[model samples]
Target: MLNSNMLRKLDMQDLMVFVAVYEQSSVTEVSEALCVSQSTVSYCLKKLRTSFENELFVNTRSGMLPTSKATAMYPHILSILKIINTCHSGIPAFDPTQKEITFNVCAPEYFELLILPKLVKRFIGSRFPVIINITKFHRDIPADELMEGRFDLVICFGPNFHRGVKGLRSQVLLEDELVCVVDKNFTLAEEAFSLETFVACQHVFPTPWTSDTNMIDGWLARQGYNRQIVARANSYVAALNMIAGTDFILTLPRRIQALTCDENTFSHRRPPAGLPNFTLDMMWSEKPSQDSANSWFREQIIKVCAEDGLL
Candidate 1:
């Protein structure tokens, strides 16, 4: 940190001269560009060295070159000067409806069936003139990648976070009770999801984390049940395909249960008849522009899901 007085009293001309000479690599060139004598450029470099407490530049056969300290200061000085200019004017205006923008949204594929359609409609109604590119989400992506701006937003099951990243808010976007789904043309009844039947059937699980193998097992232990996860996959589609036309049952979000509702032949059973529900959430990095967008998007999501009484 630097003192306010030191900052106020420092010679701005010296930095300008140093930057010009360093960039041009010729004091003669700098002097000519600034319409000053070469001696004046040398004098300013000397004064800059004293203020910086280090040699700000070193002379080479070609011309002058920046020391490490000066090199480090270059970017910060440029950013500060630009920010000063921008502050005087205010933030650049952005109108989503007409601006050409690329938005990167990351989320589980399960979200495709429920929230994604409304998100598209909201964009259409807003007349947002931008393409939305959605990419895959995995548990393995580090939170730092999202925080450091690689992603505009990441939607996941939340309550876990890293420091310096509490800017965006979180809401229970959807509540899904885990239910058991089986292949159509099967005889298993929804009412038969007793503890014994649950433990007896082969199961397919969708889990991204190896650590999660223990979480569901632990939950089963609470109900005095033990089930086998004969197959595990990272996707619901894969799990659905594997469990099709088989005795295998899948414990998954109820929205998934609705996906196969057209196959009315399939049946579902609630775990223990009273297990707590699971909630999925949308998480975004906090930003000034996100305030209104977040509220609007969340409302649209709730509205669509509520229309189906699924929220």
Candidate 2:
């Protein structure tokens, strides 16, 4: 029964109130959910009723029951609200194959070895025409850089995020336990490396270029157990090289060492007790949450990780 002029006068807020009231059947409940005043909810209901020329609902003992007219028109209004939501969320006709986009991501060498291959394959097979630029993880880079749009996203381990940063979000992409990597020829490779031996052996530590110590070193310091660090390397590969055919052993994430190390030259075992497991997390700015292309990209990453049992 709505006129063309009345329909033109309606807004999304009005439809929202109508839907809320229809579903909740109470003006007070609608106000509480929408964070509006009861009068505002009542006013919207009055306006909607006037436009439709029907008393949309009738208060009954059971609830605020919808009248026949409101009941008949409910499904149509629901569909319209859904369409409005889709439009507000992002572009209506987003096509990844036809549209070109470039996303910037910062990650460490381990991510490049394990995650990038699957992500790249997905985009290429779909002909997404998208570009992903990945850079090394740097401690000097502030974690809030993602929120500032310096990069679309970042993947790193145990990100030391600054407190009080707003509009930042993160999700853990993969979890892996710590493992000890040593040359196959190392004497301990033939038998279990005990906690005492772990503390006594010469260690090839992989410290970040910006820091003097790594996670294992920090944990060891807390427990008053210090391993002998005979050498320090910036990356896992460098640390592995320092261990090959030597008595030195490198402790790092199991998944990365598994993918990068040659089984013939290297042997890996669960690290001695007290070593902690780590998770790789993807952090990003909240601004991209509403972007269709960015949402699609995030979904693809999550899907790939889930399918591959990375999460």
Candidate 3:
């Protein structure tokens, strides 16, 4: 059963309302988020339900839960809105100083700890009214998510992470090597930092992502050596806390140690020779290459990294 008349009455505002309501799960919240009155949101929802001839949402004790039809339609509607927004953004030029813009970025905790502060400072100094939303990187394909408008940019450890993903433009932002962080009082049997001492020490590993194995473990495996990792932490901060007054050593990026560690509380030692260096990369979908706003944003990131001597 099709309702051509009702469908013809639907508009982009109605679609926006549907998405807002679905995400917020409250009509009042949707109204506040969309800067519309409650009556307007209700009218839009009513129109959408009529157009689709479905009870898209049902009132529940918990909240306004989406019906099966709404669940199925959510992604499609979101994609449509993204496409429309892209079309509308195809301007000749972008001026960050004059426009209010929001950039959604996906990155690991490393970026948050080392780069985000300086990046925000750059924006503030330049007087750009920009909003940044950061999300955790889950080792997903940046190209697919960027194409779907999930994120405007992605910051990852190495360029190889996106090797097989097509239509992605990436740039190396910075390079860092592994370093061992331990309590200042920690000492080695010998003066020189040796692999034997490193492996002998009880280590605290930082697991920022879901992967059980990391570059450190892989490198150790290749050399037929494994460290005695006694604890696994979800973040570098947590790992640092775990090794604060203990004998546990944490092996992490050198920049992280430089930025986060206190000279009095913790000291950094060079990891065993030949540990591989890693590069941080910024990636975005190639489809938006012509988007001046995105282009400008990328330039800003690179500029900030360079100014900080990280590029």
Error of 3 at 193 (Å): 3.2
Assess each prediction's global lDDT (C-alpha) against the native. 0.67, 0.79, 0.85
How do the residues 1-311 of candidate 1 rate in per-residue lDDT, one tens digit apiece? Answer: 77444344456566678668768989889999988898999888777777677887888897688889989988876666667667678554455655566666676666765677766786788787656677776644335655665666666653342222455545667767677777776676665477777788789987633334333576678877788879988777778788877888887777777774446556666765555566666666655234444444446567766776766
lDDT tens digits by residue: candidate 3, 1-311: 54387788888999999998789899889988989999999899889998898999998877789999999999999998998887898456788888789999998898888888888888898898999899887756566679877789988878464445777778889988888888888855433358877788899998876565678888889999998889998899899999988888899898888888989999878888887899898888888767788899888888888888887
Q: Which pairs, if any, clash in model 2?
A: none
lDDT of 1: 0.67
Each prediction's TM-score versus the true structure:
0.58, 0.69, 0.67
Winner on lDDT between 1 and 2 is 2
What's the residue-level lDDT of 43 in candidate 2? Answer: 81
Better TM-score candidate (1, 3): 3
Residue 230 local lDDT, model 3: 93
For TM-score, the strongest prediction is 2
After superposing candidate 3 on the true structure, give the runs of residues whose Cα lies further than 4 Å from its correct spot: 1-91, 159-163, 189-192
What would you estimate as the lDDT of candidate 2?
A: 0.79
